[model samples]
Target: MSSEAASGMDVDGGAGRGGLTTAERTTIAAAVNAVLVHCQMASNDANFKAAIRARRKLLALPTTAQCLDVAAISDAVLEVCYAMGCGGFPWATPRWWVKRRTGGTWEDLRQCDDATDDYFKEKLRMSPRVFREIQETLSPLLQRRVTFYRVPLQPDHIIAYALYRWATGETYDSGTCSFGIVRASGITMVHDVTAALLTACPDKISWPTGLQKAVVLRAFADKGFPNCHGCIDCTHIYIDKPANANGEDYCDRRRRFSVQAQVVVDMNLRVLDVFVGYPGSVHDMRMLNLSSLWVRAESGQLFTGPPVMLPFGVRTNGYLLGDNGYPQSEWIVVPYGGLAQHPTKARFDNKQKTTRGAVERAFGRLKGMWRLFLRTHKCNMDSLPQQFVAVCILHNILIDAGVPFDDNLLWEVGPDGVRRRVDLGMHQPLRPVCMESSTGDALILRDALAERMIAQ
Candidate 1:
């Protein structure tokens, strides 16, 4: 319960849920707010706590309204605001937002918390545990030191506001209806939450290191690809034409304006590395070349390891599997093409396809859980990249937590009006040309793997 409603003063004779209707609560809140007018101006700790405590009392109990000591209230509110880091005239000045409308989905928040986590999973796309963990993690950052200028929204509500918005891909106005927040506040909160999550979970989307690399190699070895680290793929994210961007540059082969995200995923479909915010018109190779991943992998910084012995007495470093759309390199291998009638080549193609599907499924699970990725977002290009990165981190976080994606959320109506599972390539542009030549040790190792597969 909120501090204002903490007193639990009900206009009702204890018949209502909290003994006070939303309106009566707001009325009491207004009286309580009066006592905070001087909280920011308070000279010392005792006076400030006393004033804040009095305000809490006003909202907590079913009480008759009385004229508050206005002078005392001003000092208290001012001191509280200053302590809150609200330094300026506008922020530190006493204000009452108690009249703001309430009672939306937030009205049932207590019930939702009290009930089973099924409600949380369905409504917010996370179990109560995951939600609480996130809330607790972000609480210290989201919480203000004081509420002298205005009552602050808790981290709990902020996270719910952002996660719900992402899960449903709903409009800003929907937050007003669902969370009873101003649409602008909802937008700010989502951005803030995204930033906080990114800060909190920076390691969620990272390259496998040290022993982790060995685990990835062994997983791929089981699939007949020795010394493999991960598979890479690119998918588009549809968005409105961002300001100051050439609209045509954002248009993909499918003619949709989008920003593309490139992902590298391990065998479990966990994101190992991610790079996003390229224009959709950019090809896969170009996107990779432009990314820090390309530089890292090329510098032997990404796949650092002692060489693994191949079946042909060959020893090589770890590499990633890619489709023909990607150019082959020592650090990455692409599927063979031409003269596919050969059983050996066909076998290699099949095996490569099997392993490469991990990245595709990674994309599927990502968009499946976060419907925001499926929608044409209005997030600015500057913020778009972080939004994608943050979502990817959350995706990996949930996977680490053993949270399951609701398959029902994965269903979407296509342009033909047929409802189906969300496509991994729903927003992907045309595939890069197969002419991207297989080159260097990547070419040699791929053939060796194929022949070894035949031998096995």
Candidate 2:
């Protein structure tokens, strides 16, 4: 029984109860003081024993002639004993306290006003409407993956918890409190939501092909980067040093352990493809070569159309804009490194840098909206890649929903003409391989494009 009930203090009663005579109140006050004094002088173990004896003695006190109420005196003495750390009262657990603190009202949070909605967007990285739409879209898959017979979690609550953790970069324990869930359940929800996004959203994040490729090229042409299909770059997602023997492989040039992710983004800042799970130590160029997108492009399967025609009667396949770290190819254009030697080369480099900023801006928007990528995730190394890809998918979804970019967070080029934010250490330029005819043709096309830009 609860201490209040055992002591005959009505558990539902407020601070005020039936009035006690002055003499009865004085007697109860004396008993409480004596209990406190004994507890203060005793060790924890001794005090617990004394409290038990005191409780029994107080409960057996007579309540007839002297108006000595056993119930009131017992309640007073137990309160003193618990305060002194003798530990007879039933205190609320941490989960119970959290529930009380948050009032378990997640639905109310979803229906907040504009100011509160903005705050939620800042905290959760998406507006309530977007979050709800995603939840509804992925509910079927998530329901199959995550189920509880008792205390079933709402799909929106699970997705919200995951987004909150990603947006705020908070630990699961702290993140769950806002959603009225325990830490273990929060972790499960994050995993399930991430899996659901991966399964449900890949169709929305396709590589540009056919008419899509034409549309993408037109967008690039409008930006003064004709024949460009997308911008390619790589960033590292920091992670805990793996506990396994191969941990050293994950350490990057900055001496921080991480997983590398390569992204291909369109002018709209939507991710076309993401290749994750490479070690941070791997060079960006190497990761690119290893990606499926590269394999498909190399096989002439990524973009299908008539070749793009440039000045001087030069024609070539659509190419992606990349930094010097990537080797120049018929399908990948890189800026000339000797820009200082010629005004034409300098102009070409400037245009290339400006165009390639799409990928940098995409990365900036991604890491800015979901700050989890900005810090080390305390998850198993094998599972981290899936989570990273899931964030990229979510990023594309938000862009599709017309979420405006925070222009203040856009990436800027440094004085050295490189993106200033070093998400991963700068990659050394890849050495030119013996040119296949296609690669030689790509170099020729790059020079032709530079000449074309100069003449313009």
TM-score winner among the candidates? 1
Candidate 1, residues 1-456, lDDT tens digits: the string is 643343323433254354555565567557545544543454466655654675565455333332132233333444444444442233534356543657666666547445757767766777888888888888877875444445567789888888888877888886787787887788788889989988888887888887777788889999988878898889988888777889999998787889888899999888988888889988888989999998887787876777877766667778888887776667777777665358888888888988888988788788878888887868767877897888888888788899987667768788999998775553432344554464555667877787789889
Best by lDDT: 1
Clashes (backbone N, CA, C under 3 Å), per candidate, total 25, 0
lDDT, model 2: 0.73
State the C-alpha lDDT per candidate.
0.74, 0.73
Instruction: Please list the residue runs of candidate 1 whose C-alpha ends up more than 4 Å from where it truly belongs after superposition.
Output: 1-99, 112-115, 145-149, 414-417, 426-438
RMSD of each: 10.5, 12.2
> How high a TM-score does candidate 2 get?
0.71
Candidate 2: RMSD to truth = 12.2
Any residue pairs clashing in model 2, and if so which? none
